[model samples]
Target: MEIVLKKGTFLVFLCVAILASAQISVKRLNDPAIVAQHKRMTFESWGDWRPYPKYFLGIQTNFAYATVWGMWAPKINRDYKDGDDIRPLKSTGEQNLRFAQLKFQEEEVKKIKAASDTIYKRSVQDLAHWTSATVDADPLWLLYYKRMLKPITEFPDNPQNFMEWRLKDQQTFETLNSTGTLKRLQEELDLIKEKYTWSRTMDMPRGKRFIMFHETLIRWRIFVQELRRYNNRTTLLLDYRSILNSHLPTALPTQWTPTSDKGIVQNVMQQYKHKY
Candidate 1:
């Protein structure tokens, strides 16, 4: 093949080829004082010479190759053990934060249970008063007064607690001096139902405590409801007495949740360490 080239282009190509093939050398600056002086001289006017493309490219290439060969290589993967997979422990600051959150949750549960206990006491007292007063005022009050009194006496709750339980039955109270025997009893039942409905609507905790609290509340309602009907209907007397037997023993069943003083702290540390 025939080729044509300008004289300047041919000369440039020859120089490049010679530079690539030859063992080139740079003569050191002869004056030791000049070299020493240059080391301290600021080159701010020319910006940074160390950041030149060639210098940076060489540095980056060396680093990339070193990283691959020394760290990311297959030999490193083979040498790694299961122990290496485990994470280190958490920092003191992070442990404190997790423990703080756990404490907050615990306090929240405490607050809820406290509030639930208050409502529970109020409801139980209200039913107790209604049962006690109605039994004493029944037309057949004398016949079974002693029989009904036996359960109330043996129950764990104090009669004094029922003193706080006032009349919430507006209909029964307004007609206290006028309503018929069965009519007053029915309205009183409505009052008991009102308290039961309120208890059912409450947002109680979801644990063993919840079951015990709800069951006791329900049994109290059943006992009271049976008492209201027993006077007019003798068949309900046995059911009324039976509910009392089941309720008295479990009158205040409390679930004791075991707690660890260091649990929150330990859990926080584990979570921060990625061990959780």
Candidate 2:
């Protein structure tokens, strides 16, 4: 009985020792220091660029052969077979311009006039879109609000340092708004009208026709530029108003009007009547 009891005691001790050893091993495996050492060893052996695999030598040999072939192959030009078409190539720009001229002749003044009208209509549409309430609800406005608020919010905590940041924000806002994109668009429209008198007559010399077409192209491009600027200004204005409403609600007037000197903010705020 005593021998049996001794054997049982030995078996229990052995099992406890095995379990304790497994726990220690697991803890060591999970230890940050031990994991870092293993990572260092792995990087030194395989991750580093110096110690490449056995197949890398084969790749190097193949690359050398490819380089030799590329260098020598272009020198061995074969004779062209009969019936192959050979033509002189014009530049891409010249070809495109020639294509445009041909298309212009086919469509003539009607198409160009229609395109000009469409551009004007699109500018009007963009104005309506800009003044809509949807601009305020954009998810990106949250990011803009956070960015604008950071300097102002931090101002009380660190007045001197944050003052510089606040000034920078205000400068950026004013610089962006001062582009006067809408005024530029109106000026461009008047210029287009003045220059477009030639298009109506269409009895000009061949040289004048080309010149007029070039001028028309320039006017169209100017319209595009002005419209882009207008859209940028629209976004900036909306973002500025959002910042103001969040931080300084009373800065804007209660009554917004078309003739009011407040500008785009007055127009946009009209959509939110209750907010004011």
Candidate 3:
């Protein structure tokens, strides 16, 4: 196929070709600097050339791929036995994010029984090394409770970190309290739902941390996108007080006035004073 290039394109192409060939020649060449130079050429051409949307998408995709890549590696390499099959250490469930606390809870009964048995056997088998009989009565149950408390105490997070990644969510939520209708609040919720579904569930420490980071970033992106969209819409409001009040009712100062193009919507709540 015929191709076209802008001026200096031939030189650029030649440099890229050399870099591409460098990987294969690295062993024969026996010099790390040569490979580094080749890499420099390739990345130099692509310097700061990232398409952000695609870059982030690539990050998310790479994260997802790396998370699940183990499912596709060569089977068992059984002859050498380096321990590839993690399904055994794992429970017989869809291998997903390990909410370790929930997992500990699920196995809590077994754990509790085991703990109790250990205590009982210890007391029966040896007095000085054993815990008290009362403590031994159901030691596992106590252990399970101790383990379960950490994650459970974090439930329904009281709106502190709920919008941690979502600046727009917080903004919109605050906005709704002032000039927004309930519908607007619902819309903000929808914005959050659109992009931030957590898909990868593997619970490896490092990999899952990356997954969580990107997942949090996805929520932030959704928030910022919606915020910009909201900013672009006219007729939303220009009364700084109104806009701010919508999102931060409790933060209101007593003497603030609403001053939009339409002037002000009088406080009908005070004037209309419906009987309870």
Candidate 4:
């Protein structure tokens, strides 16, 4: 019985010792200091921390300064260091000149914008008037009538040429009666006026402005010339009819010389060119 009890006691002590050793090993492995040391070793193997010494020094310096000042340091004049003094602030001559130049440019832009608005308003009014007038008394229609009265010899001789001429003539006649030159001119004028309404003069190129102005002038000239021609032909017809009626002492036949005098139409047709 004594020998069995001694063997059992020795086995129990050996089991307790093994358990304590395992617990000690686990605690040491999980210790914060040991883990930190391992991480340090891994980082050191990669590179020295000397390259970032300036950054660390700057952080430390800032911390030290903050601790010393504690929000009581001068904040407003902090930009000025010792021995610094304030002097009168005056702009240089060049700066003043530049400022004046900028002011002049701004004023000039204002003047140009005002002028452009005025011109655009006037142009739109003129275009609207012309558009309305053309609707009732289309100069192109009168011109076409005069043209059709001309002899066929005055037109193109070649078949292709004649076809092209007829096509263009038909197109012109249709367009004049439909969305005619006056309507197109009004549309163009309105488009430019709208474009420049919100935009500055400098935004619109000078060349574009000049080209539009030139085109408007040319169309205006053509309209005035055709209107004059129509007026002259109508006046001449009325005068001829009046003279014939006075000499006859009796009212002429309705078919003798209609309001659209065929003789006057034929005579005026010779003076007009085929081109619009």
lDDT of 1 at 255: 22
Q: Per-residue lDDT for 1-276 in model 2, tens only? A: 999999999999999999999999999789654454354343222122122223365444344323333222334311111222222122334445577788888787788888989999987665534443433443443454334323322323222231332333443333433554334545665566555544434444334544654576576566656555544554565566566668864655433212223766456567566885
For model 2 the local lDDT of residue 229 reads 56
Top-TM-score structure, candidate number: 2
TM-score, candidate 1, is 0.22
lDDT of 3 by residue, 1-276 (tens): 235555468879888999889866876586543454344343232122111122364354343323322223345322212433333223432233355656877799888999999999876655422323332233542564324332222322233321532334444444433554435534554544332222122222333433443554555456456645554332254345566568843434534433343443454233335633
Give the candidate order by descending lDDT. 2, 4, 3, 1
Compute the lDDT of residue 134 as modeled in candidate 4: 35
Candidate 4 at residue 67, lDDT?
35
Best candidate, lDDT-wise? 2
Candidate 4 residue pairs that clash: none
| Candidate 4 C-alpha lDDT tens digits along 1-276 | 999999999999999999999999999889654564344343222122121122364354344334333233366423432223222122333445577889999999999999999999988766643442332243542554224323222433332321333333433333333424334544544443443322222223334433444454454445446634544544565567667667844544434433356654564454343533
Q: How close is candidate 2 to the true structure, as a TM-score?
A: 0.25
Candidate 1: tens digits of C-alpha lDDT, residues 1-276: 124457777889999988866633222344443343343242212112121122364454444334433333466523432113221122333445577878999999999999999999987765543443333443443464335334433443321221222223433233222324435445554554454443334433223323433454555557566544433233232233345447644321122111232543454355456533
